[model samples]
Target: MRVAVVVMETSHHRDTEGRRHIERLAATLNEAGHEVSVFCAQWWGGNASRFEPDEVTYRGVTVEPAETSFCTRLPALLAKYRPDVVHAFPTPSSVLRAANAGAKLARAPLVVEWFGDHEESVSARAIGTANQFVTPSELVQTELWEAGADSDLTTVIPESIDMDLVRDVVPAEEVDVVYAHPLDDSANIESLFLGLAELRQKGWSATVIGDGPERDTYERAAADLRIDDRVDFVGSCDRERRLAIYKGAQVFVQTAWREHFATELLWALACGCIAVVEYQAESSAHELVEHRDRAFRVTTPQEIADSIVASADMDRRTVDESLAEYDHAAVVEQYEALYERLVDEYGLF
Candidate 1:
């Protein structure tokens, strides 16, 4: 299978969760024995039109990350590549429109990876061009529906984690609570801080993992609440360190206001942390806790505080066997199945 992934900006040009997700998917498909080529504005320092770093081949549609120029060149490049499937990112929307033309020219099925980060109006128009749409969560699917996407054409595929590492890594020192997310304006870490502040008289330690523009603001909020001493702001640790902490921690608190899909929360749950998700309209965090044991969904700091206290009575776990379905290989199989189904429908085999 030859897959052509279309994203105007590679992660190297602009690092974002959406870009990272698509790039990771391309690599995973490559490892699964598919011939994957990423079409984007060149991020490498050279005049070469193609760069093969690792197994995936990255074809430069433009010399630089100029949105208009890349969009103009994409259709011709993708038509020339002649992939079995054209997987595209739904951001600028123009790129999706361009990729649609390319998919038609190449006679390939177009699948849009809609991350739900763009404005609803633009996203609706962007999704209209694709044969199928893949969202990381139903929250995004619903958003796209409201944006004018056909429900029949869309599918939800959750992010995957390394369950092997979950089973193998030794736990870090135990703590009562753990919260991890980039401390951006939308982080909502203050909610966790206020929740923790309510239990100041109680004996507990919390670790806040990750860093961003608002890290100091959140740290100061912790100080203002007088819980700074107990809450450690451990900035931006790697996945293994996070998994170790999740394994050691009793509860994982998710208070981010805007998450297309709560990836860190998924990792925490697979590692066996009792999930306490604060409901936010834009976040899909609560979806992860649906009908699941040892998970609480709440909307306030008081409720989060109460849930934290209540989780102590629940049985401790090092790993949840139920989450094995979300392992990396399993999720990749879902992608493969989707690709095969599309190809069969198009009679491209």
Candidate 2:
């Protein structure tokens, strides 16, 4: 099957979970013997020079960059590519609308993936335009349904991890506590700092990963809390380093106030880290580790600290079985099945 993936950006444009998700899907589809093409914008984060306007093969997938004014370019590209199915990410309204028009022009079935927590009212038109809807979490599906999407057409396909990259290299009890998230305001870094401060007195150490605008502020807070030595702020490393941290971490701490889908938390769990997520209405992290023995859902900084301490003795192997459904191969197979069904049903010959 020839598949055309439409998204605003990819990992080439920015290193984000959503873009990485698209890249993984495209790569996996190509590896499965399908011809996959990615239609995306050239300029992401004002770095147009980084990507050429011409088409290029990236990781076994053909990537065709479009103009900033994608509305005009997308339909033509779609018509020329003539893919059997067009999979689009619902974001940046313009891109979604463009993909919708392009899919119609190409006479291909449109599948819109609702990956982020977008307002249903604002996204209703895009959701309605697509032939099928795909979401990584039930929370997103619920939002789409409430926004007037056909519940029968919407499917929940969780984001998956490459199991080959995730393995228990170190026992959980022998590893240190680790927290990884952008040091932005939404991350609620203060809570983690407070919790770590308390844990430091008990002779515990933590490694804080990721970088953002608020890094200095968080660093100062760590200094003020007198736990600066106990905390290591190793900002923004590559994937290999990040995975190594997860593999060796005893407890993976998530202090974010909200998350549509906590990809980092899922990675840590798959790497055999005891997960602890701060309870939030919008967070889907809890869904991944429903078993209390594998995770702890807490409400306060104190509780987070306590949970981390308790995780020192819990067996990390308990969470290993829960991650099987999220394996990369399994998720890719589900997507392939969905594509085949949609293509046959729509008769996109």
Supply candidate 1's per-residue lDDT for 223: 88
Top candidate on TM-score is 1
Using lDDT as the measure, which candidate wins? Answer: 1
Where does model 1 exceed 4 Å of error? 119-126
**What TM-score quantifies how close candidate 2 is to the native fold?**
0.84
**lDDT tens string, model 1, 224-247?**
999999999888999899999999
Report the poorest 10 consecutive residues by lDDT, candidate 1: 118-127
How well does candidate 1 match the true structure in TM-score terms? 0.95
Candidate 2 overall lDDT versus native: 0.75
Could you give candidate 2's per-residue lDDT for residues 144-209 as a string of tens digits?
A: 788788999999898887777666343333346888888788778788788877776587878888
Clashing pairs in 2: none
